[model samples]
Target: MNKKLVSMFLAGAVFLGTLTGCTQPANEGKQGGQEAVKVGMVTDVGGVNDQSFNQSAWEGLQKGEKDYGIRISYQESNQEADYAPNIEILVDQNTDLIWGVGFKMGKAIEEAAENYPDFKFGIIDYAYEKTPENVVGVVFKEEEASYLVGLIAGKMTQTNRVGFIGGMDVPVIQKFQYGFMAGVKKANPDAIVDVQYANAFNDPARGKAIARQMYQRGADIIFHAAGDTGTGMIEAAREEGKFAIGVDRDQNDLAPENVITSAMKRVDNAIYEVSKRLADGNFPGGTTIVYGLKEGGVDIAPTTSKNVPQEILDFVEAQKQEIIDGKFTVPSTEAELNAMK
Candidate 1:
């Protein structure tokens, strides 16, 4: 709600609060003797404490509660079967708005919106082919942010080989892979950008194994789009004395000696902004809102300077401006990436 906070995030500086177990609200925070407007979120399989977007989204909701006195709560889905049931829980609680936190929750949200015609629903990372008037969609241009970090990897890598590990093989993950690959190519054409997928967002052991494999194969830097799985990547980085690039949140603290930087996708800001819009009687139902480099939704972490050189930072900053100024497009798909070369 404060301009200063948003400015801090856009300027590549952020402080993420850690939240543990979360529960649905018990009708607290009354405004004028009436029950406060309640907002509920349903996270994907990564749960709320994945230290990724799910955690970031909850932090934003917590801020909304502090700034606007809105009652905020979240339901963590441990598996796909939990989605509809979680939405039902929020619906039963009479939440003013129900947010689904990932692309995987699209069908469940859409179904719930259709089932409960009077309620409002919003989703992240998923756009409906035909959006219900009561539902809103939010997506991001993650490729742009990943490209900046990839540029740094290309410039900083001693082995001329960088690796990318993804939680899933979805189009969203592809965006990160392709954009990172393109940025590496742009910076150093001879460098190789190795890519792999864990196929699960919470598989830390699997993620660790992948990172070790990449590092053993001469990759000195690795970027991960995996959720909790990425914690393992950062851990491996610390053990191997290598560099890891994080996603979703500023994760440098995970291994200050190892993690070089993080690709910050500010899901918290988006959630807070949307909640404020809702409080202001401007619920963005039936529309899709996209956040990108230009929209202050994504950027390289402030911790970048600890490892990346000034010239590389300046170069990436210029590229950021170039993207915002419409001077060039960062590839988000396989075909677009190939076209660049």
Candidate 2:
């Protein structure tokens, strides 16, 4: 594809148009209409069923299989130590492309890509300062989506106080928290946001404890960037008759009554697009691909709670458009958020 066509493809305008219609077997990996591609993934400690990014990435590979007849496989990591070995398993499987989900696997993906220089690799939530020739960094502007949802929390908070629960204090999760606080501050300067970290993405008990504490402290709504730990926050919100915001996927179904909405990062689209690129002989390796609001990479979930006013939703949509139009830029760091005031 030419430069203009490639730009349009990345922008999602021509993505579906560029896919091939060949009915080849999924295990073959080739370029120039030569062979089918086999894709594999390694999940983070949250596992593939975390109902978060990991699951989204796996779903994307499955989508590639359904749409383009590409083979797909994945290994679920039980802990941080399992990242490297799990990646090795995929590499040994002779996967045409290997995707490592989460920032925790950045180094592992790098090392694996280096060790197996002939293979292509991709990782989510990580942008390497010095990228490998065979690896692509797939990242998203999560703060933009978080900011949109933050508008809802700021507007709908009955007590003028909201809460944020994070899975860990890492940069990715911090981006979500900081953007959320910025949005709340923008929508309602007087709205106070309480922030806490579970330090573990899978610890639901800890998520519940912090969410409950925030609710007890006059917070009527809570937004969580934690993985499975956020599930506990959902349960807490439902039990306390409060509201909660979800992350990654559209988790409103988890507790439709209490979940106001969710900040969604489209990991599935990113993965599937990369897979298509590789198959189309347009693999984007040795660079970082950033999917932001303009690219439809992130947004608030469609499901809305009855408690949220339609006017508020309309206002959020306006803000989203403003961001895309370059009128507003969401903050992704503590200093940027502080400087905004």
In the range 1-341, model 1's lDDT, one tens digit per residue, is 54333334422321132222235554486876776778889898898889887998988898888888788888778888778767776776678999999999999999889888889999999988888999999999999999998899888999999999999999998998998998899999989988999999998999999999999999999999999999999999999999999999899989987888888998999989998888878998999999999999999999989977799999999999999999899999999998985
TM-score of each: 0.92, 0.89
Clashes of each: 0, 2
Task: In candidate 1, list every pair of residues with a backbone clash.
Answer: none
lDDT of 2 by residue, 138-184 (tens): 89999999999899999888799999999999999999999999999
Indicate the worst ten consecutive residues by lDDT in candidate 1. 12-21
Off by over 4 Å in 2: 1-35, 305-307
| Best model number under TM-score | 1
Error of 1 at 207 (Å): 0.3
